[model samples]
Target: MVLEQLEQAVCPQLDYDYDLAIVGGGIVGLTLACALQDPGLRVAVIEAKQHSVAASKGQAYAVHQLAARIFQGIGVWAKMLPNIAQYRRVRLSDADYPGIVEFQTADLGTDVIGYVAEHHALLAPLQEFMQGCSNISYLCPVEVVKTQYQPDCMEISVSMNGELQTIRTKLLVAADGARSRIRNAAGIKTRGWQYWQSCIVAFVKPEKSHNDTAYERFWSSGPFAILPLPGNRCRIVWTAPHEEAKALLALDDVQFLQELQHRYGDQMGKLELEGDRFMFPVQLMQSDRYVLPRLALIGDAAHCCHPVGGQGLNLGVRDAAALAQVLQNAHKNNQDIGSIQILQQYEHWRKRENLAILGFTDLLDRVFSNDWLPLVVVRRLGLWMLRRIPVFRVYALQLMIGLRGRIPQLAQK
Candidate 1:
């Protein structure tokens, strides 16, 4: 049975409490729940924190074109649009370098290059959308104590309101984040290392209008990004050596703003701090496998990469959509959604694509985050080529905005 037939067919009764249970109610897990919101499959989302707490986070993300389309398909884009900031151009420059590369919307023949959305802006809408999805049971402020896998179903023990309860599901998904307890409990190994560098993120109010342009300025120390936000504010993702980043974060607001202005240049005029600064060590990680038996991993549980291009969450968004597509297809065909055979289809489809992005981000950070003469010369020449060649610009933009992969059906419309 295909999708049409499955929709027309009566909802089949199942022995398990739910068809799927997702651990981690972050953006990715919630996205998966929203995508799998059909009556045929009862779903559950297990979260350790309340929705209000997650929605109050200060982080923001660069929502690529493909991710925006995925949100549109999920029916939350209209609600998210009011809070999203669209950028028409992206400026890539090396520190004080004469050669620079700029990407315009015309390069891709799209309305805009991409969008910037705050954590609250995204999570609030997603949570609101899920409230209307009757098939999705959101169990928040609950802790997962243990998980036991059986031949036919997985049993999960949880602590909710100080009481232990068990829930059974046909499939289990781990979206718990990089230090995912579910993935660790299952003994899934990962490969990657912590970088000597760290990233400092903060919001700033620019004196001049950003003109809907995003800036990526690379220095020998690290890459500094200025992402335009709603209300003429800009998000700063400043990368630097670990010690240096810590010192910067410790400085008073006045001192920090002084340093910020030096790196930010005068294009945006004076920049005022909008909120507290945050720092986190950077790393690259990929699971040995995306799935096993009745267990599967998505988002940070599956992989993590450098945040240079703002690709982290977008990767997870795509993972959610792809997994949703694969699982729906399996359900329609009357196959076990958690069977390794069916799960591997999603793994095969996304793992390589994700690896490509991981490698690309690593290469970018390594190549640009230094003043090595040979590499500097090479990178400068690359920028020159990117500026002179429309095809190069288009290809690079496509990759950054997630237009270079096997798009899931949910994002197609």
Candidate 2:
């Protein structure tokens, strides 16, 4: 039953083949299918693994309001909502600086600020929805070995269930990820750099209850975020420079806890580890072009930003919605779905917001991860003054809620 759960996140009619062929059936790919499903367009998702294997790579993600609405539009939110933890309050603080700012869900007049849920929790339901969609076909346990971009159609060659097969479509959407095969074969160039820092993550139980509060503490080392989870447990994402991250990874549970306390203080009280710890390098990546010929890139394939705001996945989901909107509109007008003209519209609409977010997150990491006196003073003053300025405070609150410029129609509830 659990294995079959991801089958119907989208709905459509009977079709063996597709008009749009999606590579990499990760979150963005599945979400794109769901977003495009309501229109009864034929779609096929080619993935590297079958349902069971791809369904449960247990990980966690914090979903912003914009993305949550996209999931609701695709018809899986109602099922996934029960397993999510809502953040009632969000606190931003610094280790060596006196700057502190707190944002409340009450201030925004919303039932929830945002959600923290396991990656599999979100993936399973979307996968289930996909299975039930008649017009959307799934090609699982396959690897994309060759991709050909033609003037009229795109061809993706894969080894499916131990046999070689090629799928032809009007458009090819890449949702693979940072190291995207679809992107590379399409000759799309990317520009980004490794942050020289790594993220150390783990789940832990704290002496004091998190009380549905999310805390992000900035230190010269990097930003450390402790997001609340059910049962008084917390998900910790600690961004530290390379050496520090390696040291943290090498420590015994007690030693690592001690170091965490030294940097994070006792805000959540004594902490105890729950699961395995992990260290991963963080980087910024952006494709030179999101569309070329009949091919398009979405999600991590198009862009990636710092995880400071937890906006990477949300940004990717927005791409899926925008692309689906353009394709849906083009279909209504009886235009070529993969035409250069139609794909350009999707590129233009998404690029504006994507660039702004990349810059904002980069600035957050650079500014907060420093001890430069003058800049530190200015940042601290800004945070302290924000509390007294009602209008400005509201403006900042809205940005955190993913309510700023140019939201996709599907993202609107």
Candidate 3:
């Protein structure tokens, strides 16, 4: 009855400048806008930074199969495919452990397990695609000043190219990031903690071919990952204690490569630093709520998890696809898109799913990133089970590549 009253209270006579307005034009935000390319619904994306700035971050992500399908649905996968490196196999091992659990495409019955693409490879295509989208108004270098929630629409005050303007939309989506200003302004609390670890990431050129294989080797300190990229190059994510990570970053390129080689193993042969190294503290964060009246949160704004399995961006991609489905359905039914009743559909669909990944990553980090004798034994045994049992291996692979959740229609192959 309250929902009915709220819907009725919204005057049909009032006009909104856009049906949906998204803040933060990063990968997640752009994915959402691309997914909602409907002629009937006008969408606006307000970003504080330029695309060039974001693309220059020198970071890369493991793009799961579901996320690839979402991009395919949005018609950007082809553009991204050439620039990405597809890894058909993944090797999971522990510090100096002879028993390495290897996963192949056959394990998941897929052509490729996942793809790795640099920040520019993904962001440039999405930005170029947005240029041709008529329904989307891309406003970059625009700062969001404030947001006012009205009974019928969301009033967003933004400073665009030095001019201040208020844009009205039926729904406001925040994909800004983990430190989202929009989310904080809405007073939405998050539940998680700053991990004791930080991750140092850099690109390296391997003397030999990577053979399209990704590696995750765990140590007492934290997890280290080698993600294959095109041109026989690889992106490495090295996690360690905060101060230790800082100290490692202080080393010269040759010294840094020496330290990296110790953990990276001899599988890829000699390695040379390809670019600047970057580091950031790791954390686990989940919003207490994902929606409020006319507002919604997706991507890093909604949750963050450890990079143990490279699940961060994939989660955000799935969030964009799922929320897109919900909003598209509401629009089709001619319902109030920003109604709490409608927005809750998105919250319910993603919150538990995201929580599951968060728990899985936290458990993996805790179990493997310590030398506790009991945990060490348990993890070794667990890894043995994963290696010996076909069912266990398949289930684990599915989860890693995002096949275990309630997949959205947009991501459906």
Candidate 4:
């Protein structure tokens, strides 16, 4: 009802200014819009594609224990609960080396270690939630062509239904993907490199039950992860060299299944491909600064890392929660949400966490992706020690489940 009014409340010829304007309607952007819902604030979401069009773009996503809690707080988890498939434990094994590490929910006295859901599953529900919130204006089928960051407000020119429209907002959030136009427009530089590897993703069904266990097997090529999905289905993420990824994508289903069997064994029995294979290049990108004047970067706009750990989206969720709380409080206090101070506070809270997770994933990639004898020995020894060390076990479990450190209020259980 509120969104319907937002569509007709103000004429496009008049001012369409908003308190907050978020670019990109992916999970991160939509979830941020959902978090920013307040009767006191007017928020606008700009996206180039419709929800159905965007839904078909990405592969599955793993929602860690912490990410799920964040969703629960945002009020969309209840709508998404029926769509998720829980992974009770996660196992990491080295195919060439004799090291296997397992993280189980039982050890932490939790019901689930994490969960896997298609990227669309979360986004669709979140978009629905946003549409119903009166404070949010769903500006869809729009392409942002011009962005101007002013001293007090940011102006955005977008083409909606082929007709150009201009909107202004006090705070502009770049929830756009890796190549963020908003971040670039803000002149926030980033430093990172693309890895030589690419990942091939596909949905498959094992002949036997998966038993809701997620597996990450490291080989000389790269990391091969099998994430559990509901109904005895699994999603395979095989990160190999660019050449190897090309070969895997070109292979026939029989050959692909045979290769997977060779690497993963018959733990889940025969593997049958259930969907078309897709491949994407992997990279590590972190913005130099997460905020600039009236602009803030969140999700892929701020940082992006390898998918070997499934922490990408969860990291963005934490950012949204922290930023939303900061902005909500600032609005209540009659302070500017776009002020450097408030944005800096959000950046201060999330910068370390983002960099630390990036470093951790990078370390895992370097240690496990190479076949150097000395490094392999050291890595194996570390894993071996972790298994026997009680204190370390507890810590590792907490880290994977996203319960370590000072959690944001919205993400806390």
Candidate 5:
């Protein structure tokens, strides 16, 4: 059903009670709502924009193997199969370092390193899936004006037509983007800062085939990644100083493409800009907490990390899965899913895991993006040793594929 029809179908009833209410229609929010919905429980999702508002452009993402498994568990993968493109390998290179370091799926005994897909194409099917399920109610294009936590339940005030309406739910989740209003109202604290670098993201049509592989190249400025999609199209994420980014983005399409070619080398052959380029300031954000009294945060709302290793969405997906499993287990055990005890467990499970990933990505961003001779020598030798040792290479590949650690319940076969 169209988003408009979906919104109109909802009954105008106040004092609606839900098992869970998620504030944010982004991927993580919607996924969490869908995951928590079942025959036994009712879930609702509230987003600031109407469903008719399409997902943003110039924001494509790569999903790790664990994320692929989570999608399968939620039953969205089958619907999204047509738009998905698997990348069997990835090539990481440094201009000053000798030789290239490659991570192949075969080396890890997997079929693909990961999958690359456009944000809209992936999210539309998820929304459609949520609509068909009877347990989910989607509230879009409505601003969350107030959020109040009481001893019994969490109360939310939403504005639709300059009139305020209240929603009460057993549990409240905040999946809104970076600046989460729900999180702010809950009085949760977050710690992060903006990076000196900015990222330029754009879709380009290349003259040569990408061969279903992604490339990450490090330069003095920052890391540039070219992720291959299904067609001759590629998504480019070029990181550099904010001033340099502004200068590059101001050039005409021809001049911009030329600069891209020079920095990107001949790997993808000639490139023609297919769409407008977008620039986003980079930051490393980690929340002080992910859960509070009957409240929780997910996705960029909870933590934002550097995109050096492309783990942002993957971490969010895992958060959704972890919360879902915890709730399911609580229900099975006749426990209160929204109880502080249950919420704290969820926080404990995800906080440590999220911090580990944040630290690893931060280290990579600092070590690889630097021009320091000592750090460069150490990293080059580290890469060389991994390549030379077959066992170490396979293990590294497995880690990159998100297969090295304990598999989450939803991700388990």
Candidate 6:
């Protein structure tokens, strides 16, 4: 009743349109909405499902130092602090190598390498916080049926509670996920292929504390990762060849647990699988274009990378931060935020950045995902060299945290 009255009271005013209309209510969309909120502009988020009722679940995200800083700028760090699980170090090992290379915060002169947290926990507080921001309006549980772009604005028609409504906004942001409907509507093409592997994720209880450390073990078949959670529980993202994954997924609880132990070894001690296992097919996809006219894509909508470095969510956060900075800069300059010129600036800055990272990461994935003798020797030697050289280590750290050069404005904030 209250929502109905609120919508009714504001419907007339909404007819005047908004400065920005964000499609998708995920973290990227909401973050963009909050970032663009101000007295001089109006922003609206059109979500296909109620925030609390959305069934889509994301994998565990590693909050890199840069991404954490961006979250702080967006006023979500403090709210997310209590729920985060600190990972003070990372240990990377190759099956062919006798020595493991460890990345520790103490060595890097920082408090922690990064953080790992469930996706849902991070978004809960963000949703609650958005309620008090007056400049943003959320129209949830509504499906966007059609969208038309004019020279000056994009008109979107959505069906809310069985009625069709149209919204005209200067800029349209598509923060939708990898299978982005908005991207398709804009005729953007994505180029990539699915990996013949599947990742199985499960929660397990370790016999000993992880001590805020994460581990990544690369085997011939694939990489097995054990990321520490808040308590004794650990999250596992184990990848395997398609046939192996199918066989593993078909195993019973006891059989599955045994396989996990055999593959993971006794690093943290005995592991008791705690949650039901889930599998996701791996893919490496990148869009041909990130922006077009008054529309821009962010997050998984723009690119999807391998999860080897745990950089997927970090990359998405960077996208949101960068695009937000671009829009904010235009707003400060008294320029239209939705103008094609303004949107192109965001595309220019983000395209090269994401492309470079994507290429580098793709190379890493190919190099590490195999068991060829020559490639194994080279990678093991490279790891040894990286561990011995301080300058090389720092460079690697910078690349891992997405802090290689001048930090983005939103990240600095």
Each candidate: how many clashes? 0, 15, 0, 0, 2, 0
Q: What overall lDDT goes with each candidate model? A: 0.91, 0.83, 0.91, 0.84, 0.81, 0.80
Highest-lDDT candidate: 1
TM value for model 5: 0.93
lDDT of 3 by residue, 1-413 (tens): 88675665343446899889999999999999998886367899988887689667677999999999999988999999999999999999999989999999999787898999988898899988988899999988898999999878899999987888999998999999999999999999999999999999998999888999999999999999999999999999999999999999999988888898999888778998886899988999999999998999999999999999999899999999999898888778777788788889899999999999999999999999898899999999999999999999999989887899998887765
Q: Model 1 compared with the native: what TM-score?
A: 0.96
Candidate achieving higher lDDT, 3 or 5: 3
Candidate 2 residues 1-413, lDDT tens each?
53332222122222325789898888889999988877867899888977788877656778888889888877899988888888988888877556567888767788888989887778888888888888888888778899887666777788987788888788889999889988887778999888978999898898998889888888887898988887888888899999989989999988998997887678788888997998878999888999986788899999998888788888888899999999998778666777766788899988878888888888889988888998788778777877667677778767755678677888776
TM-score of each: 0.96, 0.93, 0.97, 0.94, 0.93, 0.93
- How well does candidate 3 match the true structure in TM-score terms? 0.97
Give me candidate 2's TM-score against the actual structure.
0.93
Best model number under TM-score: 3
Ranking of predictions according to lDDT: 1, 3, 4, 2, 5, 6
Model 3: per-residue Cα lDDT at residue 32:
95
**Local lDDT at 38 for model 3:** 64
Candidate 5 Cα misplacement greater than 4 A, ranges: 1-16, 54-56
What global local distance difference test value does model 6 have?
0.80
lDDT of 4 by residue, 7-85 (tens): 4322223243898899999888887889877637789888888768987775788887777888888888998878879
**Model 2 C-alpha lDDT versus the unseen true structure:** 0.83
- C-alpha root-mean-square deviation, each candidate: 3.6, 6.8, 1.4, 5.8, 6.8, 6.6
Candidate closer to the true structure by lDDT (higher is better), 1 or 2? 1
